[model samples]
Target: MSEEKGLLHGVWETVKTVVYALLIAGAFRTFLFQPFWIPSGSMKDTLLIGDFLFVNKMAYGYSYASCPSIRIPAVGIDISAEDFCGVFKGSDSRLFGSEPERGDVVVFRHPTRGDDFIKRMIGLPGDRIQMIDGVLQINGEAVIIEEDGFFIETYEQQGPLGNTPMCMNGSVGIGGDCMKERMYETLPNGVRHAILNARDDNPRPFTDNSGVYVVPEGEYFLMGDNRDNSGDSRVPATQRGVGFVPLEDIVGRADRIMFSSAGRSMFAFWTWRSDRFFKAIE
Candidate 1:
């Protein structure tokens, strides 16, 4: 009888320890940082599919959309929220940081939908943006782009499995030679990062150029590194691309890649991208 009680007590203790650890981790992820995964090629070359990184939650001031899934255990503070402007126009805003700057790879909730989107911050408040024939123009001046040679990698697509006989997410390097025009683009704020130009493809008419768009106050213009492929601020929010993202919707900045896998699926453990582990994102 005593042995039975001891065994039961031991099991209960183990459970309590795991629960406590989970609570601590939940609080940390909620308030400080959280891990994120890249699932699309939009940020390709910079952040590849299967790249897992930790977003600095405090990089920008904590918006109501900051911790959208974490509920602080025991303290009763629910950081998990999509929008905190409850029953008002703008009620709960600002937690830390001042304003987002150009060149920062940011993660934020979709302005219209709650789905998360990550893109590079291109135009800040009051900045005029235009894209002329695949070239980015800001404030009436073109963003300087210097060719950095060429980049050839396999295109492991992200979609439903078993479709076109192409390599899936976990198997990135299995496809054919996918070549792209690579360059270093300097933003107005002097933030320089790599952007891709698919020479084989033409910029889509809708996203390539239309008219000058002046970013309204408290809003920003974002785009993906894969210039010709990304669906960004150039597209309407209702259509799935991120329109002008509000400052209040930004969640965090992607600083570094924790790890990367080449698998088409998250479960493809065999395709882990060991070379990309702990790589810093410029």
Candidate 2:
């Protein structure tokens, strides 16, 4: 049989080299860079909890939230981004779009829990946005901050969902020493980041005083620079928060931090962090 036709032509050339390396890694993760895996700290100390980052999908272009969404909930495989481009989603129009300034650090697509959510942008379209006592005002002024002080850590569990981290030198007993109140802010076209503040003595914590918002036009306005724990857009999206998002659910712009892993298993490479590897993401 001619050695079974040379072992079926060497298993059909190793299945066409694993289907051309999975179609060139699925067209380079569907039109360039996607990865992203911070798992939450809500952009703390500028995106922590595990870090990993990629998400540049041409920095705000394609639509249907730039497709690519596989979500592996312990083998369940959720799959979203409207199941890979839901007829290019209700049309907030994208495909080559571009416009997402106010302090960058994006990564969207959760207009209704379609998953992915990194933040930062902070109001745009029509602007307005509020939050008095805890600072960030915009369109009515007040975005400066300054006092960059404490941020400390290790009050025990963190990452891999262990959570626990809101402290202004409060309760912390699990291995003690935690804090918060770091400032910096700036944003008024001048960027400047770092903003955390765990309870500046409440002063009326409705996300520290809100109710202004506005920002409609094409929709934008994100948050979570750890501002008192961040649920963002000051809360609404039917209450769970992350309200005014859609700019076709903007899925892009995260800039750097190739890997970080503070522990709970990112293969636990000695719990990495190595000065946050590629870092950048400011």
Candidate 3:
């Protein structure tokens, strides 16, 4: 009988410890930094697929989107940020709000899908933005773009999604060289970063050239570093693209990459990109 009581007490103590640990972890994730894994090649070269980073949630203050979304398909758990902090939503303001500077890489919630997205902040509220002949134009002036050679990779399956990269050097068989025209683009604020163009010769009419977008107040314009391949503010939200994202949707700034893997799974230890560990984002 004494043994049974001892076993029950030990189980209860273990359960309490697990509960306490989960609560502490939840608070840390909610109020401080949140771990984010790059899942797409949109920010390539700058932020490659499988790159993992911790977003600084305190950078822009707390918003409803700051709450982490928990999604585990295998266990059938799918909770959105709205589910956790829906009451704090429905407004364009954030608690302890701070404006984000141009060229800062940010992770935010998708306006339509509520999924997380990371991109470089290109236009602030009330900024006139456009794309002319594959060049970024802000406030009636074109940003400077200096040619920076090429970004080359193997024309094969990449990351867990098994997506092939779009290449500037036309069609290539699997395992062949895939390349993109890389350039350093200087924003109006003097912040410069590398941008990739997959189709330099045949620029897309919609992406390379677009009508002027006067970003409304409390909204921001963001774009991927891989310019031609990104479906960003240039495209409308109705067309499955990230249009003008509200200020409240801004989650946090991605300051640095914690880890990176070139293979399909990060668990494949041999595929780790050791050089990219703790790499700073420009």
Task: Identify the leading candidate in terms of lDDT.
Answer: 3
- For 224-280, candidate 2 gives per-residue lDDT tens digits of 898777677778776777789888888889899988888877997997888988978
lDDT of 2 at 282: 87
Instruction: Compose the digit string of candidate 1's lDDT tens values, residues 147-266.
Output: 997767756454223222122122345466667778899987889899887643343675556688889988999999987778899888988788899888888999999988776666
Cα lDDT for residue 174, model 3?
98
Measured on C-alpha atoms, candidate 1 has an lDDT of 0.77
All candidates: CA RMSD (Å): 5.5, 13.8, 1.5
Please report how far candidate 1 places residue 144 from its true position, in Å.
1.0
Better of 1 and 2 by TM-score: 1
Per-residue lDDT of model 3, residues 27-54, tens digit only: 9999999999988889988999889999
* Per-model TM-score versus the true fold: 0.84, 0.40, 0.96
For all candidates, the clash counts are 9, 1, 0
Lowest lDDT sum, 10 consecutive residues, model 1, at 160-169
Error of 2 at 161 (Å): 18
